[model samples]
Target: MGGCVSVSSRSTCSSRSNGERISPSCLWIDMFRRKRSRRTFSDHVTTLQHLSSIPSRIFTNGRSSSACIFTQQGRKGINQDAMIVWEDFMAEDVTFCGVFDGHGPYGHLVARKVRDTLPLKLSSFFDSFGSKQNGSGANCCNGNMKSDVADPVKETSTEDRVESLWREAFLKSYKAMDKELRSHPNLDCFCSGSTAVTVIKQGSNLFMGNIGDSRAILGSKDSNDSMVAIQLTVDLKPDLPREAERIKRCKGRVFALQDEPEVQRVWLPFDDAPGLAMARAFGDFCLKEYGVISIPEFSHRVLSDQDKFVVLASDGVWDVLSNEEVVEIVSSAPTRSSAARILVESAAREWKAKYPTSKMDDCAVVCLFLDGKMDSESDYEEQGFSSATLQSNHSGNVVESDDGQNSEPCLQRNFTVRSSEENDQYRRVPIDADVEDAENGGTEDQNWSGLEGVTRVNSLVQLPRFSEERPRP
Candidate 1:
């Protein structure tokens, strides 16, 4: 497998001391001589100072323009899994980063495609949501402070609607990519899948969405003055009850690896699609038929001033360092980029120490540091309405034929609206397992205050909601 990567890395130096004023010819002559010495130097340094005397616009990012990506090919004995860091310091108010960890063959292509497309999909969704607002009232996504109580129901409805639209758009994008893969003469014979973890920063709030086992962590300045890693998303492993049920429905079972000498082998069952351990993922088209869904889990939170940095990494790095260990290492580092690189390099070193004669697996990590400046979290709290219900089934939208199979149809229908209090805490437990099946119930409508228009479909695997009543250290 081959990897195609384009990366740009930049470092800006801010110094307080001013050098003694020098002659223009001395600087010009030195610059000319340096240019003659190195051909590549001509492409390096495109700072405004070199181009013209006009002043450069100061960006809100607190740094000059910078971008970088790193790509590598693993040794012949190992999988050529390429990892990347596509950081652009100039984006300001929006720090975008993602981790793509691939397995099987041509993992590099999977990594490259994820890095290029995922962020664009998210940004486009945001754009669509923002464009709906008249922009004159309290609807301002540009972070300008405006006063007015927002409608929580409307906001929730808008958010849910946009989220569902984006989810469909994401699927469409993947389907288009699949079409391209089938048509391309060069990409045939590549059977691979990758896990993606993408994080986007809007002011002080961070939104992280992930698929598979890749992870993202938020490190906060703890009470002891040391940084503590606060995890955002849950790892989608085969152990979860919901996941176990899904796998079992697919005629596959997860087995505990016993210490027995004769049964020491750890492997997925023969009937399992792709013979992979992960229960949920993207690009493993072979498993889609059996309900091995690729729905992503997301976490949205406000980062306080006490927050230090974020770490997004592949399983290769996590296999070595725990969250606490990662916090310790990142806290000691001077910059987020260095911490990210160190994490990957550290994992490689650990692998070498454990196996003296073997090459390590491909590893990658990306970290974004909070530069001690305060950005109001409220400025980034997305306020909108979303009306996407959990099930795709509704009255006339999808019709059931006389044969009990769904028929293709185009329709719109009114859906039952359940209030937060009325619909709160309804669970369906089957009276008899042989006769009845448990159906998803409801809980208190999860809506941000005043944003009542947003109607969120209940997740089957609901996470315990964070509450101010309960202490969360």
Candidate 2:
């Protein structure tokens, strides 16, 4: 807790419009309640975004009613996952949460870079646009609420504009991120990159951006008041027909190996170089020609009064835990600060049990309770569930699948797909021209690929830009 850098005074970043700045407070997961200090943007704007990844859990307390906890562990010896959450984003009632999952040789570097930098980009843009979301300045931002402003008109006018602003920021930031990866003096993205899935919660609305296989889900009460899982983003895997179709349309090969029949991947049209499992990602310049893209899938949802929490996780968690199972585990946590840690530990245990032969993958989770805060005085009774009973009753329960319908025992065969060499009619053209493929010198690909110390991440890049010219090897 002491070692990890805790970002504070993020509300100051929203001060340009709200004119309200928060006092310095520990801004990690809701694990630790530190003394609050009034800080300003000029104070942390530079160093905060460059904060290094930590091996242990990091807690950043923002408000008394919100709690977020994070944890990570290495699998197969490398942890190529990263996560970041900026609750009280531009608008006080909003939160920005992101998880990145990296694969390949330099995946760890790419994931960490995105994990630390993306939110800063989003925050900068939000403040720049001056787009206001209703209730932005109320108690949420520590600013005065415009009580005279009508809700309907203010919401109707601001929602679309603010949303459009966020979309533009996502697109621009993703593009810049990929470009940075490709040109990184030390990192190589030719065959490496990461998946990204993020959600911006402003007021009751959620805006999500996803790329690759990692996922985001919401836990809310159905009409009957029972807890239910609502999937907020699709897993952008190569198996998706639309994804596969797009790859083929770009002359990119999309098929699975005989041994790994279920795991569809993208390969170089000319050389069997890097094979990426997800359809979209940042970097992976080598596969960009074969229809592998970095653009994100964006969607929006309005929160209901019954909405309880949101979960953003890397594939490591999704591969073993059902959206419902995750909801159950988190919802049952003895406390809000312990929710993410418990969920990650559960995934690690499942990975060991289900895939005994393979190394465990890095796992990361961000849990935001709708009304839960980071106050030490807030008791479990106030968190909407019985802490004493939530975890005790479901402590040993096994998770089934993503769908939550199957009750079968957990098995490796249910999620793991082996990779093998199999070929379809994929074009592999050799190039004679002096192609600038190695446009940027990269980080030690071999070393970073294993992510010896890096931990978990998730989801995307910019929108698709189909080019007629083939990619060079």
Candidate maximizing TM-score: 2
Best by lDDT: 2
lDDT (tens digit, per residue) of candidate 2 on 1-473: 00011122221123224454332111111111222244466654454533433222132211124645454644333456666676555435667778888776556667767776677666555554442332233243333343423344434444455557667777777776777687878766766688999888765567788888778889898889888887777677665656777898998887655554445567667755455677899888877877888888676665667889988888878766777788999888877766876788888887666655455666777787766455354454464333321222122322212221224322221122222322121112221222121113321111111111111222111223366988798
lDDT of each: 0.42, 0.57
Instruction: Assess the local accuracy of residue 327 in candidate 1 as a C-alpha lDDT between 0 and 100.
Output: 78
Model 2 lDDT at residue 217: 84
Off by over 4 Å in 2: 1-65, 131-154, 375-473
Candidate 1: TM-score? 0.54
If scored against the real structure, what TM-score would every candidate get? 0.54, 0.66
lDDT of 1 by residue, 159-249 (tens): 3443344344445444444444445464321234567776655444465666666677888987888778776655555544456567677
Which runs of model 1 end up more than 4 angstroms from their true locations? 1-92, 133-190, 252-273, 334-337, 355-359, 372-473
